[model samples]
Target: MTERLRRALDARPRLTRWLLAGPGAVAAALLFAMAMPIWLPKGAAGIDNIVFPLILVPLIWAVVFVYACVEESLLRCVAVICGTAAVCGLTAAMAFTGWI
Candidate 1:
Protein backbone atom coordinates (compact mmCIF):
# COMPACT_ATOMS: atom_id res chain seq x y z
CA MET A 1 0.00 0.00 0.00
CA THR A 2 2.78 2.40 0.82
CA GLU A 3 4.46 1.67 -2.47
CA ARG A 4 1.25 2.31 -4.35
CA LEU A 5 0.67 5.50 -2.44
CA ARG A 6 4.19 6.66 -3.14
CA ARG A 7 3.75 5.96 -6.80
CA ALA A 8 0.50 7.83 -6.81
CA LEU A 9 2.12 10.76 -5.15
CA ASP A 10 4.89 10.69 -7.67
CA ALA A 11 2.37 10.59 -10.47
CA ARG A 12 0.59 13.63 -9.20
CA PRO A 13 1.43 16.92 -10.80
CA ARG A 14 3.82 18.86 -8.63
CA LEU A 15 3.23 22.55 -8.36
CA THR A 16 6.65 23.21 -6.95
CA ARG A 17 8.35 21.53 -9.84
CA TRP A 18 6.05 23.26 -12.26
CA LEU A 19 6.52 26.53 -10.46
CA LEU A 20 10.19 26.13 -9.85
CA ALA A 21 11.43 24.38 -12.97
CA GLY A 22 8.78 24.00 -15.65
CA PRO A 23 6.88 26.34 -17.95
CA GLY A 24 4.04 26.03 -15.52
CA ALA A 25 5.46 29.04 -13.74
CA VAL A 26 4.21 31.16 -16.57
CA ALA A 27 0.79 29.69 -16.19
CA ALA A 28 1.02 30.16 -12.46
CA ALA A 29 2.07 33.76 -12.89
CA LEU A 30 -0.85 34.43 -15.19
CA LEU A 31 -3.22 32.76 -12.80
CA PHE A 32 -1.73 34.62 -9.90
CA ALA A 33 -2.03 37.91 -11.76
CA MET A 34 -5.62 37.30 -12.73
CA ALA A 35 -6.47 36.25 -9.22
CA MET A 36 -4.42 38.96 -7.57
CA PRO A 37 -7.07 41.65 -7.77
CA ILE A 38 -9.67 39.33 -6.31
CA TRP A 39 -7.48 38.00 -3.54
CA LEU A 40 -5.85 41.38 -2.85
CA PRO A 41 -7.50 44.27 -1.10
CA LYS A 42 -8.30 46.62 -3.91
CA GLY A 43 -9.20 49.33 -1.46
CA ALA A 44 -6.15 48.76 0.70
CA ALA A 45 -3.88 51.64 1.67
CA GLY A 46 -0.58 50.25 0.43
CA ILE A 47 0.82 47.76 -2.10
CA ASP A 48 -2.54 46.75 -3.44
CA ASN A 49 -3.42 50.28 -4.38
CA ILE A 50 -0.19 50.93 -6.24
CA VAL A 51 1.65 47.88 -7.53
CA PHE A 52 -0.95 45.52 -8.87
CA PRO A 53 -1.41 46.94 -12.30
CA LEU A 54 1.82 48.42 -13.60
CA ILE A 55 5.23 47.47 -12.31
CA LEU A 56 4.19 44.21 -10.67
CA VAL A 57 2.29 43.02 -13.70
CA PRO A 58 5.21 43.64 -15.99
CA LEU A 59 7.58 42.18 -13.46
CA ILE A 60 5.57 38.99 -13.21
CA TRP A 61 5.50 38.67 -16.97
CA ALA A 62 9.22 39.23 -17.15
CA VAL A 63 9.88 36.67 -14.46
CA VAL A 64 7.69 34.14 -16.15
CA PHE A 65 9.64 34.57 -19.35
CA VAL A 66 13.04 34.42 -17.73
CA TYR A 67 12.25 31.68 -15.27
CA ALA A 68 10.69 29.60 -17.99
CA CYS A 69 14.07 29.42 -19.66
CA VAL A 70 15.97 28.46 -16.53
CA GLU A 71 15.68 25.79 -13.83
CA GLU A 72 16.30 28.13 -10.94
CA SER A 73 13.41 28.37 -8.49
CA LEU A 74 15.09 31.23 -6.69
CA LEU A 75 14.61 33.47 -9.69
CA ARG A 76 10.92 32.75 -9.65
CA CYS A 77 10.76 33.55 -5.98
CA VAL A 78 12.67 36.72 -6.65
CA ALA A 79 10.17 37.52 -9.35
CA VAL A 80 7.30 37.15 -6.94
CA ILE A 81 8.93 39.24 -4.26
CA CYS A 82 10.31 41.83 -6.61
CA GLY A 83 7.08 42.04 -8.52
CA THR A 84 5.28 42.86 -5.30
CA ALA A 85 7.96 45.34 -4.39
CA ALA A 86 7.75 47.04 -7.75
CA VAL A 87 4.02 47.32 -7.34
CA CYS A 88 4.31 48.67 -3.82
CA GLY A 89 6.95 51.18 -4.81
CA LEU A 90 4.94 52.42 -7.78
CA THR A 91 1.83 52.56 -5.64
CA ALA A 92 3.56 54.62 -3.01
CA ALA A 93 4.89 56.99 -5.58
CA MET A 94 1.49 57.28 -7.23
CA ALA A 95 -0.31 57.82 -3.96
CA PHE A 96 2.22 60.41 -2.91
CA THR A 97 1.54 62.18 -6.16
CA GLY A 98 -2.23 61.93 -5.66
CA TRP A 99 -2.58 59.93 -8.86
CA ILE A 100 -4.77 57.53 -7.02
Candidate 2:
Protein backbone atom coordinates (compact mmCIF):
# COMPACT_ATOMS: atom_id res chain seq x y z
CA MET A 1 0.00 0.00 0.00
CA THR A 2 1.10 3.57 -0.58
CA GLU A 3 2.29 5.52 2.44
CA ARG A 4 -0.65 7.95 2.15
CA LEU A 5 -3.17 5.15 1.91
CA ARG A 6 -1.62 3.40 4.91
CA ARG A 7 -1.78 6.57 6.96
CA ALA A 8 -5.37 7.19 6.01
CA LEU A 9 -6.34 3.65 6.92
CA ASP A 10 -4.50 3.91 10.23
CA ALA A 11 -6.23 7.06 11.38
CA ARG A 12 -8.88 6.71 14.07
CA PRO A 13 -11.99 8.80 14.50
CA ARG A 14 -11.54 11.77 16.83
CA LEU A 15 -13.77 12.96 19.70
CA THR A 16 -15.62 15.33 17.43
CA ARG A 17 -16.76 12.51 15.21
CA TRP A 18 -18.08 10.64 18.21
CA LEU A 19 -19.87 13.70 19.58
CA LEU A 20 -21.47 14.52 16.25
CA ALA A 21 -22.26 11.00 15.13
CA GLY A 22 -23.60 9.95 18.51
CA PRO A 23 -25.35 12.85 20.27
CA GLY A 24 -25.71 14.83 17.09
CA ALA A 25 -27.59 12.03 15.39
CA VAL A 26 -29.76 11.67 18.47
CA ALA A 27 -30.57 15.38 18.44
CA ALA A 28 -31.52 15.30 14.79
CA ALA A 29 -33.67 12.26 15.41
CA LEU A 30 -35.44 13.98 18.28
CA LEU A 31 -36.24 16.89 16.01
CA PHE A 32 -37.62 14.61 13.37
CA ALA A 33 -39.79 12.87 15.90
CA MET A 34 -41.17 15.92 17.67
CA ALA A 35 -40.91 18.96 15.41
CA MET A 36 -42.87 17.48 12.53
CA PRO A 37 -45.99 17.00 14.57
CA ILE A 38 -45.99 20.70 15.41
CA TRP A 39 -44.37 22.26 12.37
CA LEU A 40 -46.20 20.25 9.75
CA PRO A 41 -49.19 22.21 8.66
CA LYS A 42 -52.49 20.42 9.00
CA GLY A 43 -53.52 18.34 5.99
CA ALA A 44 -56.56 16.60 4.58
CA ALA A 45 -55.51 13.26 5.87
CA GLY A 46 -54.70 14.05 9.45
CA ILE A 47 -52.55 10.98 10.04
CA ASP A 48 -50.40 11.40 6.98
CA ASN A 49 -48.49 14.36 8.31
CA ILE A 50 -47.48 12.50 11.45
CA VAL A 51 -47.04 9.09 9.87
CA PHE A 52 -45.00 10.30 6.94
CA PRO A 53 -42.61 12.15 9.23
CA LEU A 54 -42.29 9.14 11.50
CA ILE A 55 -41.27 7.11 8.51
CA LEU A 56 -38.90 9.76 7.22
CA VAL A 57 -37.11 10.72 10.42
CA PRO A 58 -34.97 7.59 10.64
CA LEU A 59 -33.68 8.18 7.15
CA ILE A 60 -32.96 11.76 8.09
CA TRP A 61 -31.10 10.65 11.19
CA ALA A 62 -28.99 8.21 9.22
CA VAL A 63 -28.05 10.86 6.74
CA VAL A 64 -27.20 13.34 9.47
CA PHE A 65 -25.19 10.68 11.28
CA VAL A 66 -23.11 9.89 8.22
CA TYR A 67 -22.47 13.56 7.63
CA ALA A 68 -21.45 14.04 11.24
CA CYS A 69 -19.11 11.08 11.12
CA VAL A 70 -17.27 12.53 8.15
CA GLU A 71 -17.34 16.13 9.39
CA GLU A 72 -13.81 17.17 10.40
CA SER A 73 -14.57 20.31 12.35
CA LEU A 74 -15.70 20.13 15.97
CA LEU A 75 -17.29 23.57 15.96
CA ARG A 76 -19.46 22.82 12.96
CA CYS A 77 -20.61 19.49 14.32
CA VAL A 78 -21.56 20.92 17.72
CA ALA A 79 -23.34 23.85 16.16
CA VAL A 80 -25.38 21.67 13.87
CA ILE A 81 -26.40 19.28 16.61
CA CYS A 82 -27.11 21.86 19.31
CA GLY A 83 -28.85 24.15 16.90
CA THR A 84 -31.13 21.45 15.60
CA ALA A 85 -31.91 20.17 19.09
CA ALA A 86 -32.68 23.61 20.43
CA VAL A 87 -35.02 24.39 17.56
CA CYS A 88 -36.84 21.11 17.85
CA GLY A 89 -37.08 21.24 21.60
CA LEU A 90 -38.45 24.74 21.50
CA THR A 91 -41.00 23.80 18.88
CA ALA A 92 -42.07 20.79 20.83
CA ALA A 93 -42.41 22.89 23.94
CA MET A 94 -44.45 25.51 22.14
CA ALA A 95 -46.73 22.87 20.71
CA PHE A 96 -47.20 21.34 24.12
CA THR A 97 -48.19 24.75 25.40
CA GLY A 98 -50.68 25.30 22.53
CA TRP A 99 -48.55 28.07 21.11
CA ILE A 100 -48.21 26.34 17.77
Judged by lDDT, which candidate is best? Answer: 2
Candidate 1 clashing pairs, residues 3+ apart or interchain: 50-91, 51-87
In Å, residue 51's CA in model 1 sits off its true spot by 5.7
Model 1 off-target regions past 4 Å? 1-27, 44-51, 72-100
Model 2: per-residue lDDT, tens digit, 1-100?
Answer: 4555434433644755776688779777877578887767668877866887788888888988987877665556666777787888888889889887
Q: How many backbone clashes does candidate 2 have?
A: 0
Would you give me the overall lDDT of model 2?
0.73
lDDT of 2 at 55: 88
How much does candidate 2 score in TM-score? 0.74
* Per-residue lDDT of model 1, residues 41-81, tens digit only: 76646667345754476677677656544534444454564
For the record, the alpha-carbon RMSD of candidate 2 to the native fold, in angstroms, is: 8.1
TM-score, one value per model: 0.34, 0.74
Question: What's each prediction's clash count?
Answer: 2, 0
